[model samples]
Target: MTADCKGTVRNLDRNEAAGASLQASGQRDQVISFRIEHTDEHGDVTGYSQVELRGEVIYGGLTDGDRVEISGRKGGDGILRPSRAKNLSTDSEIWVSNRPGVKILQGIITVIMLLAFLTAAFFMITGISGGRFP
Candidate 1:
C-alpha cells in the first residue's frame, strides 16, 4: 500500500520576500519557514519535515498548524515520493461554481411546469366538451 506523508513548505522563496528586503535594506531576505508535524499510521511522530517551494509569494502561506494532505509511494531508499500536495485553504475553493447557471436552470424548470399545467387544463376542457366525463 502507498503511504501518505504530510509536510509544509519550510523555506519559501517568493517575490514578496525580495520586495520586503529591497524596501527595508539592500541585503537579501531569508526564505519563509514553516514547522510541520506529521505522524504515521501507528501514531508515531514522523518528526519535522521541511520542503522549500519556490514561487511568487507563496500561494497560501503555511502556518504553524496548517493541515496538509500528501499522497505518494515509499521508495526503496525509505523515502516517500510525494505526488500530490494539498493545502486545506485552497482545496475548498477549488470547486466549480454553479451559481451562474442556477438562474438558467430555474427558468427551464418554470417553463416545463407551465407547459405541463397548460396541457392538463386543455385535456380537462376537451374532455368536458366531448362528454368523455360526466
Candidate 2:
C-alpha cells in the first residue's frame, strides 16, 4: 500500500540490539495498541474497546504506543503488504552489547601483568647468580 498507514507504536516481543537485523526475507507483523470506538448515526459513541494492530509492522522505534507508518509489499501472508517501515519518532533508545570489549581489555591487562612478573623474576635470578646481593 502506498498510502501512509497510521498506527500506534508498541514494543516488540524480542529484545533487539542497536543496528541489528530487523528485516528479513519473510512476513513480519507487529502488535500495536489503540482505542476503538463505534459511533451511532447521531455521532454518539455507542461502544469502545482497546484494539491491537497486528500486521506487517516494520521496526519503527523503541517505545510502546508510538505512531508509525508501514510501507512495502505484503508477502503471501494475509497481513498488510509492508515493504518497508519507519518509526515516526527520531528519539529512540538503541541498545548495544559491549561485553566483548570489556573482556578483551581484561585479558590484555592480565597478560601484561604476567609478563612483568616473569621479567622481574628473571632479573632477580641473574642478580643472585652474579653475586650482586648484599
Best by TM-score: 1
- Estimated TM-score per prediction? 0.33, 0.31
Error of 1 at 54 (Å): 2.6
**RMSD of every prediction:** 16.2, 12.4
**1-134 in candidate 2: lDDT tens per residue?**
23344455433344222333433323233444333334576867675333333433333344555545544333343244333445556544322222446557878999999999998899886775564576
Clashing pairs in 1: none
10 residues in a row with least lDDT, candidate 2? 16-25
Score each candidate by Cα lDDT: 0.49, 0.46
Top candidate, metric lDDT: 1
Candidate 2 residue pairs in backbone clash: 9-65, 9-66, 72-82, 72-83, 73-83, 74-81
Give candidate 1's whole-model lDDT: 0.49
Q: lDDT per residue, candidate 1, 20-119, as tens digits?
A: 3331223343334343467677867778654333222223334445566655555565444343356764452111121436556777889999999998
